[model samples]
Target: MLSALLVTGLAACATQATAPAVPGDTALGPVLVDAKRMTLYTFDRDNAMPGKSVCNGPCATNWPPLVANAGDMAKGDWTIITRDDGSKQWAYKGKPLYGWVKDTKPGETTGDGFLNGAWHVAKP
Candidate 1:
């Protein structure tokens, strides 16, 4: 019984570790983050109305999309988008979300208002 309990505890921990991070309030305002709490962003070029993503190829390399697992489900304002690569990505308010490669730490907003305002930090 003790060994079974231990195994169950370990399984719970593993599930928590792999769970995707949800949107939360930060100094930059309410924003979506990854499991590590790194800030997520959105591209102005992408249309939020139809939930379209235009960041691909080299653009995608610089700003990696916040991917969603097959098991992830849409909740409230958060939704999943299908990328051109056929992978799933996370979106907020119909706008596809991304993570800037240059942001190395949590709560960093270095990618905010970048590229002549084409890129901005995801806010709620």
Candidate 2:
């Protein structure tokens, strides 16, 4: 079965609309999207670390984490977690968010069910 993160009223992750870091209600259901309405995703592998992410280097190049700026802080449901590399990341209820490279346009969810179902479209 496909898993979903049911977050409502979006907790944290406010990069102030820079790069469009916000959840959006779209045709693909209640999934997160950036400013340009690009679909966002979450990797099940990152769940192994709870709110932290493991998709670094090449993995990151493919699925970029929904990053946080230097002063970004957790608010309501959103929280910031430091990666192994000491960089900060945005997490919703302890799950890190990401974007897929293959999604060439807004609302494209090509990464859903990717890697034998290790990746899924992030829900809100």
Full-model lDDT for every candidate: 0.82, 0.76
User: Root-mean-square deviation of each candidate, in angstroms?
Assistant: 3.7, 11.1
Displacement of the residue 49 alpha carbon in candidate 1, Å: 7.0
True lDDT of residue 42, candidate 2: 80
Worst 10 residues of 1 by lDDT: 13-22
Model 2 TM-score, 2 decimals = 0.78
Q: Once model 1 is optimally superposed onto the true structure by TM-score, how far is the C-alpha of residue 23 displaced, in angstroms?
A: 4.4
Q: Give the runs in model 1 whose Cα sits over 4 Å from its true position.
A: 1-20, 23-27
How many backbone overlaps does candidate 1 show?
0
Tens digits of per-residue lDDT, candidate 1, 1-124, equal 9999999988866654443556666677877788788988989889744687899999999999888876667777777889899999888878888999999988888899899988988875
RMSD of 1: 3.7
Clashing pairs in 1: none
Model 2 RMSD in angstroms: 11.1
Model 2 Cα lDDT, one tens digit per residue, 14-63: 33433335677656687888767888888888877687798999998898
Off by over 4 Å in 2: 1-20, 25-27
